[model samples]
Target: MATSVSVAGFHKPLYSTTFHGGWGTSICGDNSTVLIKSVPEAVRVVKPVRFLPVMKNINEGKGLFAPVVVLARNIIGKKRFNQLRGKAIALHSQVITEFCKSIGADAKQRQGLIRLAKKNGERLGFLA
Candidate 1:
């Protein structure tokens, strides 16, 4: 007698079992081994924001060119760049939130940071 068993579309099996009986039942082919691996928590990887380049330029005494560069960026409509900038902004908010939590910021102080982030986000075109 010939028997074949396979699990399709499964990359890894969490558990496997083999039964040996008095009737000569045995694993015919490569034995399936169950591997227990510790899956690390999903990490939020914030990519570098494209706006950093422009910000760096402005910080390096080229502030006068900001408006022109921003206008050009707006006209170009770089969706991916904008998305990255949005992610950067969200990461910034997360950092702020963590800082507040660590320092035990009061309700009033937390609210102040929230308002400041929102206002700066708007001014920097990070928020709609």
Candidate 2:
């Protein structure tokens, strides 16, 4: 007797019982059977994949233009560099908010878009 298991688009007997009470043999597609211990009423659970977004600033001195950032950091110093980056990001966000208002988008929609931008930007190694 064979025990059937359906997965994906493949419908076939996953394992066959040769005798009583010890083991079951699973048939591979290439016509090979491997012995697997049989258990009653087994439930299989697969873990879902989770994605983590990485947040990194370009000015932290990494990438093709690392040298440029290093030089800028050296010249402008840490405090001023942070100030410029903060100002630029704030200006960009303001521009987005203004554009959204101009388009007659509601506050809820605008907030959602802003949050999405932050998430996507963080994933893409930009300012969040």
Measured by TM-score, the strongest candidate is 2
Q: Rate residue 110 of model 2 by lDDT.
A: 83
Per-residue lDDT of candidate 1, residues 1-128 (tens digit): 23444445323333346443312122322332211112233543358646544332223223444465466557767686577667887788788888899999977897799789866655554343
User: How many clashing residue pairs appear in each of the predictions shown?
Assistant: 0, 0
Compared with the true structure, all predictions reach lDDT values of 0.55, 0.61
Alpha-carbon shift of residue 53 in model 1 (angstroms): 33
Q: Report residue 42 deviation for candidate 1 (angstroms).
A: 56
Clashing pairs in 2: none
TM-score of each: 0.36, 0.40
RMSD (Å) per prediction: 17.0, 13.9
Query: Model 1, residue 116: displacement in angstroms?
Result: 0.9
- The per-residue C-alpha lDDT of model 2 at residue 116 equals 84
Q: After superposition, how far is residue 58 of candidate 1 from its true place, in Å?
A: 21
